[model samples]
Target: MKVLLKGTSLLLLILAGTVMGCKSPENASNFPKRPNILFAIADDQSFPHAGAYGFAEIKTPAFDKVAKDGVLFNNAFVAAPQCSPSRAAILTGKNIWQLEEAGTHASSFPKKLNVFTDMLEDAGYQLGYTGKAWGPGNWKIAGWDRNPVGPAYNEKELTTVPSTGINKRDYFGNFSHFLEKRATGKPFFFWYGGHEPHRVYEPGSGAKAGKRFKNVQLPGFLPDDSVTRNDVIDYAFEIEYFDAHLLKMLKLLEEKGELANTVVVVTADNGMPFPYAKANLQEYGTHVPLAISWPDQIKSSKKVDDLVSMIDLAPTFLEIAGIKSAPVMTGQSIVPVLFSKGGENTSKRNYVLTGRERHTHARPDNLGYPARAIRTKEYLYVKNYKPERWPVGDPVPPNDENNKRAQTEGFKTLFPGYHDIDGSPSKTFMMKHQHEESVNRLFKNAFEKRPEAQLFDIQNDPECLYDLSGNTEYSDICADLRNKLDQELTKQGDPRMFGSDIFDSYPRYSPMRNFQGFNARGQYNPAYAD
Candidate 1:
């Protein structure tokens, strides 16, 4: 009886040890088991707008929290100033120039190119996206039956609202649904693309909501007036709205007990939609805000000043998911900077590059004005391949008699009417001063016919107000940047850098030409002549 009792006691002790071993904390810092990824992208947002980035007028509590908890990169940029190309680069981890079809705006993406989402899904992770995804273009050719992100929502689900009269589809409700449907014990990837702060802002919305124009700081390139101030305020309102949705999404994640394990990255597709900002390769055009948070992994808040591009995002996402990247991906993973115990490295890239193809339907034969640029920490060198073409589409007089009459009567109107059209006070101011000597000088300074090469000192002139390309003092800087750009172009396999003879060898893809209005009948409208 004593021997039997002792054996029973030993069995109980072994069972207790096994139970305790199962309860031990999972060492998630190692490989194989990956954390979930949540990438939230905003449309047409600029740098320094969120409170985390130092914008006092706008309240972005969620973004600020992410920055406060993790890492905020001060020098993050996009490969292209436009949406399609930038998004393509982020997904494929390839340079825009290398993704020929995907390189152009509204162009059809080829099926041959592999996306990070596909790799992640293949690696046993559930992948989906809510709201805007790869494009305003067709993804069918890319073998996607539905949106690359996922399936669309029902009509009733789509028509709901967060606040009274405000669309809920534009917020986190859809994102919440996406998270709920994700399978248990499996990781998920979601892309929350918010279509806020793009354009056609509600007039007086900011002032009505108690936002004061007096607190607004005018950019040097824009005219300082009530009209411009009000325009800026409207922009602020939309940015705040976007932030509100982000806050709700964060709450949802927390409630699900997944906040600690999930990696959240917040950023924008490109710069603002203002003139000379969006669709241009300037600092204000390509520079964007980036904030990342991972409570279970990243323990402290920090700021990194390395020159990181949107293209790096794909590789970083793949690295975090423990997926191997393809050799074609030119972008390097930023995981080392985020997860390393040592201090973050800011000496990664010596320069960043961007370019623009087509913007609006302004040129004849649906031609686009091509320009490429290289931006260093202190200097920006641009090469305008086509100088004679109008940087902004060619001017087209108002077709409607009432619109023409309004312009004649001194009311404001944006010309060409192809891209943006609004009767604003700034438009009136621009019209009044369109031909004045001082205004002409400013216009020349901002946008004018340029030589093949242009350079600017960004430190002294943040708005790119002056061109120091001709200045002898900075001649060495220009030569150095030019040589660096040439080397990079060669490395990237761009035919343009090789010679004009090889330009024809590279396949040509039209940038948003069909969507902008290139007639399929091949007929020309002489009335729209420049």
Candidate 2:
């Protein structure tokens, strides 16, 4: 009886050990043995454009599928309004102001900064990017032998008319090739940057392709005309085209049996290119779509409205890959939000900040309108660092014969029926009017001087049509936001907020303005008069 009892005890102990071994702490990580990453970025896509974001005009099945299966961030914002600075922020996980040249449009990224690709490569992961990657500038000085995407990635060739050629690098095709070349067991990260939906679109590309202009929804700032509608349709056509390629990439991943383990992130660098959109610091300008998917690990689909920024992407990627982020990265990882419990509170910030240094080469001395903004749920407060400079840029007077002739002819063709048109016909019509009153107001709205501080009630004025800076009702909120922003700037060691003379001491570098030997008008005028 004693022997039998001892045997039974041993058997029970073996069973318990087996159960404990099967449910180890290692299983809690839920990380794949070797998971792949695919980060697809669009050139100029704004929020609510993708079908997943609730826009019916364009169908983005691949992006929608990811959102349906994973998580969608409804309030993700980019660090800057333009392409280069915004992309730089995503790469470095630092605000644009922290990066010197990389903060400006068409500027060369400094070699010293640590990018995510470098961190991943150091962590024993294969990294390569196809299509646009840290571009519109010379990359050699940035310590890159090739594009920052990777050394193995293929270059995409341009396809356009002789005079107006477009960069037609097949981003999807390159991504497929990158996946095929990766070792069977090694994980790889690929950046699929699509240069679509940007400006200089092919006229009637939408109509000829069966897209109806009537289906387009015009923004309140733009006129409700065929030209504007057609422009939007053309924009949608490119978006659809981008989606088609994205679908192809997803199929390739699935066929390779890497779909379940792969983490796919779909987003854009900045807002859509429009009159009051792309270059500005409005909600529509900095607000972008962000969706992520990881089927093997992520259990449910969730829509998060927490305030997130493009700067957070780097840290998140590193954390997922079991790699530590560098010390200088200002962004915090959002991994908790991704795999949070139902009742988990994972909001990192109550507000998001964005700014700009230089955009286009339209200003005197190539000086851009330096503005910083802080956006909360109900309000947006902007501080124009240089109110004396043009808000848009210095405007070239229409005194030249050709400009004058174009102005006269454009006005005549725009308003043919009215002998005396009162109250500017529309945005397009006002563009042709060269009169001082008409021109002054347009410039004031677009390029003239602005106040040092501006406030907008984004809830009511989504387009930021009215300025409530002078309103006493919002004065307290404005002051609080301003104080918060100043504290942040001080923490970041910005000289402007610290009241230092660094602004006057620093040398100005013109990347977008003079890098390509083009003048403010985008013409190849060889006069170095500036």
Candidate 3:
């Protein structure tokens, strides 16, 4: 065995030819010794939105193909509802709470944390990524020389695009470039991080593309109106765009004779960028679509209903590559689930936990709405540590002059205050109609303060429209879930258990917004100063 340095910081190990013997299923004589890993992650997408999930309005033939070829996971949740922290959880194989600064949104990734990609690189797998990877935050600020995911292959750009909001970067072209640059006979780990279906969609693009508002299914948390429906349709268009690239990548792999030897896992960073989702701990916010396929190892056309967390992905990848997970990683590997032939599988989780701290500069002093949740097969119990703080954000004053400026420069740029929800046509429409009798309840659900403890029977109320915490009949169920959540969070060393403000003390790296009383002095966190 030999070790070599690549570039300035990356320590690439060049193992002897004998390294080829390190395979997951050594007995499979026809399979490649070490399978290549192709991980495709969409920017902001929810579960049941893919064609494989019976969402006919959303065209996702590529995702459907993967589901048909492998396992389709019915219950997959992220550690955080926001992209940065959720992505960090996937890379580190730890829940957002288990991570310190890395746990919060738009915060620096601590250098000491070990990511599976780094471990894969050290074990002789060629590592690279294209499009969005492990950020919306600064990895370099925390002492990394490059993006935490891997090297970038985002040079290729599309000349003509379908929508203005869609990224022009040719995701498929860049993937081809990565394949061209790979070292011979080395198993590769490539991240196709598509920055699609997020927010700021081209208004009415769905209508122009021949999509009807009638076909769009509005979630119960949102208003059942044309404006909101169109917004969802536009979101679907971007999702289809993301899937198109995945199809191209799959075709390229097949042409290269690498499809059968590759492990393909497709999912999203978080849910759709919407008011009651995205940064929130609701079902759509945390639960995401997941499909995994490996011709040589995994069985085909199976649907798994077991609870799975995004953190488990890192451990699974490491196990497949014949590498061990980091000691700090708390997630259990799903390799057993993957290898299961069918019914009565060994992989089953009692519950999966999710939480969040800070999203954007939505409140004064950059304070985040702190909350933790526990989701079992039947119910979801959430405990808002600070129920006093507004869940979405402090409301923007109606008479503020910034409202006019926001119309021109956008709500996000001028900070019209409900900054947790991304600036979009749907948000604008909802705010305009918040005073109306028909839309008032939906608006309040999306943006309002809440009780500390809330419980929902997710199976019955998938929309989470009714909180069962206050109901006497469900009191026992709520109490049981709360006790379970507290015990596990305490055992896992969550700072929130000790009433620590550690998450809020982490410095934010993205563009800051000015809310009421948000001054320069309040913006700085000296504890995290360089």
Error of 3 at 130 (Å): 0.6
Off by over 4 Å in 1: 1-32, 150-170, 325-327, 340-347, 399-432, 436-442, 445-447, 498-518, 521-530
The digit string of per-residue lDDT tens for model 2 on 371-431 reads 7899987888989898886665544443534334535543222122111111122333435
The whole-model lDDT of each prediction reads: 0.67, 0.68, 0.82
- The residue-by-residue lDDT of candidate 1 on 161-264, one tens digit each, is 33332344644777777776778889988887777776666777778778899898666766666777888877888788878888998988899888888889
Tens digits of per-residue lDDT, candidate 3, 404-476, equal 5545653344435687888887788888898998878878878888899999899899878888899999989
Q: List the residue pairs that clash in candidate 3.
A: none
Per-residue lDDT of 171 in model 2: 71
List the candidates ranked by TM-score, beginning with the highest: 3, 1, 2
Query: What total of clashing residue pairs does each candidate reach?
Result: 0, 0, 0
